[model samples]
Target chain A: MESDKKIVWLASYPKSGNTWFRAFITALLNNGEVDINNLATDGIFSSRRLFNEQTDLESNLLYDEEAKQMQGNVFNHICAKAKQRHLFVKIHDAYTYNSDNLPVIPTQNTLCAIYIIRNPLDIAGSLANHKDDTLDDSIDFMNNKQSVFGKQEDEVNTSLQFRQPLLDWSGHVNSWTAKLPFPVMVIRYEDMLADAFETFKQALLFMGIKTDKQQLETAIAASSFEQLKQKETDYGFKERIRNTSFFRSGKAGNWKNELTSQQVSAITSQHQNTMAKYGYI
Target chain B: MYYYRGFGLIIASQIMLPELLPYTLTSTPDVHISIGKTPEKLTAAGTVHKVGYAINPNEYLLQFLNVANYYAANGNNIIVEPLAGSDEKSVRLFLLTGVMAAILHQRNAVALNAAAIKHLDGVVLFCGYAGSGKSAMLTKFIQNGYKPFCDDVCLIQHNDVKAMAAYPTIKNWENTFTGMGLPIPSTDNKIRPNLPKYATYFHDEFDTDALPVKTIFIIHKDHIAKSVEIKKLAGIEAFAEVHNNVYHRLQIYPMKKEAIHFQAISKLVANINVYQVTRSSNTGFDELFQTIQKHL
Candidate 1:
């Protein structure tokens, strides 16, 4: 019945600029030194470890629907018991309600949300590499309205994460933007690439993080794509797919070279409304 | 009624627990379990704890959705109230694990979230976050001729730091059975309803005798590496590793059992060798077995 308004959500679809933003925040918080393996944020929103620790329940033992319904309780518990003044959580689940018609992520515990949007064409290529699937599979995954991760039953014994339902790319964006119970800030992947300094500064300011121009510039440089890729190469990123790189080419318009015309058409056709609304088209 | 041996205690239960080895000792039971009507909420008993459980110095109550509610008091009794139409396997699974764990905490014992295997002169522990290949490595060890000590949870007494097996069942995923080229036993029951995981009983091979705490291997995952690496942890890091691996550590503070938990961890850390085994994504269990074979 009590509220713990300390959660700042970092939400995005897969292969968007979520990790990059996390890296920036990590570096910003750590005097401009970020360990690719250890980010400064609280772990992912769907982390099974956090779920088990917070609720004293074994998520792997429960059915997907049973666990999904308990997420609001888990997050609220996390907020209530958190020692940190501001707990930043990276999330991939769309803004959806539970079976109880209450938000899966309790609005009472949320301080704010930073929703990162990316071009679907670019996402298809990156998602393919991340998921160990083909480009076609990735495209279908992006367009599928019932897209979800960590749903395999066999993985119940070995996975460190729980199920995350993403809906579709369009649905994912609309779920966060259409109705807002908390303050929400939308950042585009392309804009981050275009003006890293201003885009990141605005994000920090939006979170009420105070830093001078020098510290912000230094943190940005420390978390540059090259730096993150090099760190991954040197120390091996835990988030990377077993055989693939997580910090693959960070350019915004690489879709022009990577995705075929048909692939682009498929994405645009499925997510045209969202793409146009965000000026991606 | 059925008699069983778990958490270094004799258990006489009204419900069937097919996973635990049958009790053979003639001594009186340390714990008794029976069917009873439990309160919907435990506010009257004590302060409501986190995760909907309630606890005081000696009594603890926990509920599993659509399964059963379990109450433990003074480390000697457990009361189960099953939901209507609840399956026996589901009810017993919760009773044997979470309920038993709560009971252990009440007894001032430290329950670890790791599998225990008989190695050398004592038991060696394989612990990590879920999916860190602890069970796979334990399975590999079993295939290679080592004895199974305990699966899932390994209990340590707070007063003596002796390692104890609460139950002798390996609750493994269905694929673990097939992946090892073995068929799942026809009698194997699902650990929970609507889940592919099954509890494989080790009644004949389970070691019931208390053993001295020995070596512990903490498995880790390295995404990009091509081979496995093992490192020895000493001093504070080793202490923290063992302390953090306590089963349901989040429940300790709420139960006001931090003193017992801390004392048990400190005793275990002082007496054991803790090693961290980092397995690359491409590394197979055989290579991990080979890497660990030299240490033991």
Candidate 2:
């Protein structure tokens, strides 16, 4: 059935397979050639430029609640003005509401969301590298309820991304998977790695994106971790963390070698319920 | 009434704007501001443009929810209507920033959302979206003996190819102050109660005179860059970058003055060197500042 929803959120915690999924989708759109630097989609949901263009106000002048409210308004504005059959917007923010009881992502405009989840154990190392912090610190961040990204606390941040409330990893996952206002499809990062074709095909079918077996296989081949790594080595990835490669290994269960027993236990204990549900234990 | 000189215009306002550089000359103001009733919406007969704001020819209106009721800019006059719960300081903040920016657009000037510093040879502007570290970089240059010409709003004089001096204050977050190893100055004017940024005033170090535009650096902070690097932009890339950095660009588009704005920016870019500064988050303040200094 053709879905009426125009907006689909590629939602995930940082270091999850969100970007990889985006790359696959980009490859599918571009006939099996993916440009790591330039994707088919617009930037992330919290992009300050998008916020400014949609709201016509400088985001720095706004308080957090005002910015959140504007984010909802901008989403509706985008949805109303969109010419495309489907718009995929990557969002790192957890599903939450502002003080006014409005979803940070407007429910009316959001047709559905694809929430990509990754193992906390695997995410710790990748997130640590991306943030240039210790693995323990990354674990701590994953547990901290007040964890926020792109905050303008220090130095007026001029980054294109705005303040995103992650609210910890389990919180992030649960927030999106809970009684969402719209339909949600959860895809595990590990599953995507094991069976790329089936996993991605399911996601595409769910988003109502037309695809053939050849297109799906070609996209899978083009966006493979090795191919992405080669592209990163050839031309730098804009989203790569400082002093680190964006396609750093993409290996699952590296926490087996990297995480200390204490670190592993800490993460497991903190996210035990969610980890067990996702078969990460 | 208080008189301030900014954006090459003499502004007279009923409220005291301590952030602006006081206009020294005894001349009639070009723009006047007062507390008055403004319409909830613009009723003028013209193409209504809505971006982040709704505007019509000769009139612009914006509301900041519970903070303020409305800010209206018409011709050379501005009216600030405060919401019932809004205080004097919050009203003035919106009036000075959003209202002033709208008025500048109404005046058909090329304004940039940037911070600038006056060097020995000429002035250089740092352009980026808010929180892109323009103010932080300007503050860094100021602390290192360079003089600040403008804080956030930069108005370009296309004819003379100069950058106009804006207010004599810098709005910075408390973390910025602490990160730079400086104390947060006490001020009653917080940009917002929940926001950590405060409007810090500068005195003798703030340059009030317009200076020739020499260079423009569009800054982008990357979490993954190994070091702070500067790359020169050329051709359409330069134009596109500069165009995106225009202050209140959305407001200008609605005024049907985009051609004029483009012409001004094109001329400005043609004469001055434009570079993109990629700063890694882990780069030390001193190192980042030194990299910019070497380029300057």
lDDT tens digits, residue span A111-190, model 2: 78999999999999999888778998999999998899776444354556778999988999999999987899999999
Q: Which residues of candidate 2, in runs, are more than 4 Å off?
A: A1-4, A151-159, B23-27, B43-52, B203-209, B232-237
TM-score of each: 0.91, 0.91
Off by over 4 Å in 1: A1-4, A83-85, A153-155, A204-215, B40-48, B157-162, B255-272
Under CAPRI classification, how is model 2 graded? acceptable
- Taking chain B only, the TM-score of every model is 0.92, 0.93
Clashes in candidate 2: how many?
13
| lDDT tens readout by residue for model 2, B36-126 | 7777777777756354457775778776677664555555888776778776776777777767777888878788888888887679999
Using lDDT as the measure, which candidate wins? 1
Supply the global lDDT for candidate 2: 0.81
Residue A50 error for model 2, in Å? 1.3
In order, candidate lDDTs are: 0.82, 0.81
